[model samples]
Target: MWKYLKIVLALCGFILNTMILHTNPINDVTNLISIIEKLRPLHKKLGKPGPHDWLAHHHEPGQTFQEYYKSNPMTPRGKRCVIYIQPLGEFTQVQRRIVVLTSDFMSRFYNLQVKVQKDIPLSVIPNKARRRHPEWGVEQILTSYILNDILKPKLPADAAAYIALTISDLWPGRGWNFVFGQASLRERVGVWSIYRNGNPAESENSFRLCLLRTIKTAVHEIGHMFSMSHCVKYECCMCGSNHREEADRRPLWFCPECMAKVCWATCSDPVDRYQILAEFCEEHGFNNEKEFYKKSIAKLES
Candidate 1:
């Protein structure tokens, strides 16, 4: 049964990859394996994890978390994260994707790095960013074209950085927050895209907010690289947002519990992650989300 279940997880991962145009190098994965093991021993002793155990992780389930654990499929450390981002040029729609990425990272406390690579023309990619951020006109988002293509991976100079690339049409998501990364902490990470925001003859502030959201989205997705989850304390930027309005509702911070979870997830210190995020946010002026959003709209319109 345990072996069969492992097959299920692997198959599921493969199917998901095909659907999203995403890939997991360790087609033979690990994170899920290790987690199941560590928890299984105690799970049986304590009845096992809640019904929600298989809830968001896979979108599908097979045998059981405990069953897999007893079987001992893999180790504690592995990169189970794998994200596929569609293009949105550089506006609100793009921001939505990033938000989804960030929220997912916080929820799991996993390191999922996101990056951008030019792909199809913004015009070709649809534009949901405009619908949400009407303030930004369409002209700005309807940037020049490349083709109906995937983003080319661009590795950063720093050894600490890596890259992944892809491009999808507008309105990308069937889940709350998902990401792409190697199961092993040792692997370098990255993701990027060129998605369209909307289709407006004129540009506006709403368009700019759309752009701001895209930046936020990238930041959120990249946060996954560190293995962090949604903050329970204060409104977490990692918290899921279904609409543009909700996107503005959360603050960017990992709750205390989530912070602890990330530490365990990445085998790193939580404070260290927090410090990195805080500093990055401050540097990019992500602290002024509202202002930035508003500015995005204004900028695009001009």
Candidate 2:
């Protein structure tokens, strides 16, 4: 009777433990789904695309929060959690300042540690990969070389994503005028250029614009590294842009669905993430963006 009783108690404990393990993840998903619903009204659905808009050409079926969660998207895990930014070339004082601010925003955005590695000279790009644009006359470096030869070789074992930031212009290859950025999602590597983001030294407004553009590019590429597809459902940072006009029109914050993805991927609390982003936007004079983040926080908390 004693032996039978002990076995029954042990079995009960195992069943209880198993139930708890399953319960927690279900609770997490349920909470995330609730948050997504709460924030839905705050986001604008993607409008009809103009002639040159990204959606006009790309025709991608956007991913919903449910779909993204089901896809087993790549996420930072264990020791491989830091996002490293490698500076690929020279930057002006203003550009360097932009880089620092962008890094801070990225850390807050992803809830990950972001370290800016030391500068790497542009000379590392071979002559064959360098070209002077035939029609535009702007000097550009091949993006493939940077991702394949430079960043991939130096990719840290603990890096969730390794990205190169450069002031120089970037081109993927022949027939392309320029690319704002490029990345390998599965491999967790990317490169972006601030060449067209505008001259920060020109004026205060110019500096702000340049900083906003840089932050957008960095977060967008990093979003891809996390297996997020271009957002076609809303006016979001994850949405692809085919031109500077389209890019400038995009908000610095992710839409409701994409926001859910970010929070889920990083295992971040929605309220805390919004609060930090609001503070960052306020400090940087992004008044409009700050208000949006504040609204998100209020919605989540309520």
Candidate 3:
């Protein structure tokens, strides 16, 4: 377990253990779904995508740069192939994969129509705040929010939600893991991680945790869009984030109460979704997904 950190740190250049939440008997899945819905942007408020937009991104780990481009086109080359360089910051090969994978999961489960483009070039914005922020990077949109915040009060909320919708990280506020951008009536979300130490390489469980959290971040932020606040249902996804530590300590399960709302947003039933989600979790090795889901079911006493 300890050795794995070397790889993660070497890759992203940073590695740290955030809080970990343990799920007790699931009581209110409905409460969870409600929170995810609240994080979404107004459906119509989203920006339109260009045909040239990339579907998503993934940096090939343990593969040569040439090999990486081969599987993933270096330009708007293939069907959904769009090469991303450091549009506003640098992304190691592995970290790149994290973005692509997380984006794909959200895009698929949510049936989102947004494109996943990568490597926009760190110099694109030319803003000092973006270029120099230690917590945030050039790629993340927080710098833009800072500039746009005064002109609008709720700009930060929307911006945080948007990034939360698509990228990885909880970005609750101060020490919030995620970075966000806001506009007139909508917000944009982005991820910004600084590499200083090293990254995880082994421990598939760790990687899966990161991936699962990515999905939660998407759902949690989306909850903000739907007018729901954090769920107080025993450390659930919508519990609201004041920092990354709290975000990590959150269990990625929904209570019965929240599940009711998620079904409405995606237009599906919680029972049905949980059944499918369990299998998905098994395929992906997410025990918590399966464990917490049991809480939503009406158990037959022995």
TM-score of each: 0.35, 0.90, 0.50
- lDDT for predicted candidate 2 compared with the true structure: 0.89
lDDT of 1 by residue, 1-302 (tens): 99999999978876674434212322212443443233322111212223433223333222232332234232123234433343333444645444454434333324444333343344543553223324433222111121112222332332232333233322223332222111112233434333333332135554444444544444444444443333222344444444445554444433333333333333443334444554444444456643433332233234
Candidate 1, superposed: residue stretches over 4 Å from native: 1-169, 172-212, 219-234, 287-302
Tens digit of per-residue lDDT, candidate 2, span 3-80: 999989878876775455334443277788888899999999989999988888788999988898788777776456
CA lDDT of every candidate: 0.37, 0.89, 0.39
Q: Identify the leading candidate in terms of TM-score.
A: 2
Among all windows of ten consecutive residues in candidate 3, which has the lowest summed lDDT? 16-25
- Candidate 3 residue-wise lDDT at 204: 69
In candidate 1, residue 208 scores what lDDT? 45
Give Cα distance to truth, residue 121, candidate 1, Å.
5.2
Which stretches of candidate 3 lie above 4 Å from their native place?
1-90, 107-115, 131-202, 294-302
Model 2 stretches astray by more than 4 angstroms? 1-27
